[model samples]
Target: MCRWLAYSGTPVLLENILYRPRHSLIDQSLHAKMGVETTNGDGFGVGWYGTSGTAKDTPAVVREIGPAWSNRNLREIAGHVRSHLFFAHIRASTGSAVQQTNCHPFRHGRWMWMHNGAVADFQRVRRDLVLAVDPDLFLHVEGSTDSEVMFYLALTYGLADDPPGAVARMAGLVERVGHEHGIEYPLQMTVAVTDGLRLWSFRYSSQGASRSLFYSTRVETLRSLHPDLDFLREASDDTRLIVSEPLGDLPGVWNEVPESTYGVVQPEGDAMFSFAPALPA
Candidate 1:
């Protein structure tokens, strides 16, 4: 129900990814090709860690309840700010109120999280999931979107220490609660979470038809494949992107993340790993 992009690589102006691409995230805010809706102008947000390692203690975040394509301040800030890890999201609210608080790439300390799909039958299972959250973490939830609730739920189940296991446990809880309410497919999501270091993305649904998710091939590989593409030339060898859809129509540059799988992108070692759903215990 939304579109988002997570970048982990060499520091570069935000606009290079948010605006310069043929179908950038800002363009997707108004012209998403694969989303359930073409226009995701409900709201938008950008979160990035600053250049100085000290700024990692305080990530720069700016969110507004306006169309990203038309936000002058967003344009100004994106053109100037530089960060190695950043997240930008354009919202298409499913059932939440349209406000800045409801925007994506929700943050907590050094960790940031965002979602592009919904927990099926959220209202039916909301109470159950909310009750499962640790009270301290529960108080941190300031919005009504299922996305934020899911983030806190992951934290409750130990996201910081073991992201994949915590997330899988959260999904298990959602499935348990949704089934109790008679919903056939209790979960649908393409989610990204990062701790200013490692990045994790998951694409899964109870029915096996998850939303679209993609990760770019290495920049060096793309350059060799399409040497004439200028965009490929500008990016660093290790530059990597995980998006709700391809940022541009560069064949061989983007690979679809298989359904029911999760991907981890680690820049320090430049490694990518895909994992299937953990077998039930």
Candidate 2:
């Protein structure tokens, strides 16, 4: 439905991830190889935890209602901004308006979120799901897209304290509500989120076939695998990227995020585990 990526690593110009790769996020906006849509041009957004002296708790986000590939402001911003953690997303609206508020990398306090799939028959479940969001948090829901609703639901369910758990609960609620509305496959998503520190990503769907997702292999291992790649040599051992698809054909550099699984990236290392929807306790 859409394509997005999360970067948690040493600080570098945003363009290094958004524009430099053979199939950079910018490239994917126009020529995505794995997304449901070949082109994701409805809108785009980037949210980054800026270096010290800038915003440290919540990320500073820049979003536009135009196609990312042709946005001069986005191009300039990518070149000038750098961060240790960031998210970039290109939208292909399932049904939402193509407006800035509908762009991804949605921010709320210290957390930021983006997704690459839809809550099936969203309009049917919209009322139920929206009514479930905590009123205080619901006030911050600025867009009509299911993606934004999902974000707020996660927050309402406990994202600030338990990301993976909260997301599972959010998915549980979506499926629960969708089933009531007669939707069989209530959800399909490859999602990424961060709190300006650790990053959490998930791949899951009610029907068992979720959107595709991948995370880069260990940085040190990649360096040993391809000594000629200058980028790997300069990257920190902890650097990692989770994307909707393999950024390129680098054989040993990317690992598919197993279906129905979630992973976390932090300063210590990365961890992966099974993911399943459960009603919030």
Candidate 3:
């Protein structure tokens, strides 16, 4: 289990989301309120797309296996770097080795992926799922966590062509394989994926009890509600965030993503839609 946040909007200093908020991601790294564990200090990582033309050319990432709050370099970099699309994750390893390679916000070329839940009976189904990954993509897997395997699986199934469909298929594959091994609740996840332009997040589980996920209300709307808040004034109208939990106690500023649903955030628009496990072919 882990805690993560995805930001898509006007480029702003990373600190605004990582530290400025009353209950920021760094705070969650040590005081997560809704995660299975209170402190997700196993490791942390951040991925962002720079000002370069496309994601491949401007990709920048910083990760370490130390507590995020104690990392001076992380604090310095976060305060200066800026990006319109970014992801930050604080981890709490679930059977995975605590190493830099095992941190979340895993990247592959122009895409980035992170998850906040575990696959039920991962060991039992790991073989089946790993074998399903394309060998070319399989070679890139440098870690042993189910999360990394899940990302490659999505790529194998065409994540670049259709993210939502690819993820739906990936989830279906995991469910199918897990069931064959007699595991009842095959998946539990609050996942975030980005391609430098658009962001997609999902909250779902095979058993219907998904972990918490939320998205912030539009900055414009919030400005009207809390006209005196200085932070709201500085943020862009489209500034939005999707997190494992609300970052602060701003009443009505955060909305729970419905059970079995996924959300898409883009510079043009945003929407939340129903999601269900895809049936195996």
Q: Largest lDDT belongs to which candidate? A: 2
**Candidate 3, clashing residue pairs?**
none
**Candidate 3 lDDT by residue in tens digits, 176-239:** 9998999998999999998887899999999898889999998899999999998787888878
Better of 1 and 3 by lDDT: 3
Candidate number with greatest TM-score: 2
Write down the worst ten-residue block by lDDT for model 2: 49-58
Between candidates 1 and 3, which one is better according to TM-score?
A: 3
The 0-to-1 C-alpha lDDT of every candidate, in the order given, reads 0.86, 0.90, 0.89
Q: Candidate 2 lDDT, tens digit per residue, 77-148?
A: 989998899999999999889888999989999889999899999988899999999999999999999999
Badly placed stretches (over 4 Å) of model 1 are 53-56, 268-281
- Give all TM-scores, in the order shown: 0.94, 0.97, 0.96
Off by over 4 Å in 3: 52-58
Residue 252's C-alpha lDDT in candidate 2?
95
Sort by TM-score, top down from the best: 2, 3, 1
| Per-candidate clashes, comma-separated | 0, 0, 0
Poorest lDDT segment (10 consecutive residues) of candidate 3: 51-60
**What value of lDDT does candidate 1 attain over all alpha carbons?**
0.86
Model 1 over residues 61-168: C-alpha lDDT tens digits?
A: 788989999999999999899888899999999988998888988998888899988988788889988999999988789888999998998898888898988888
Error of 2 at 26 (Å): 1.1
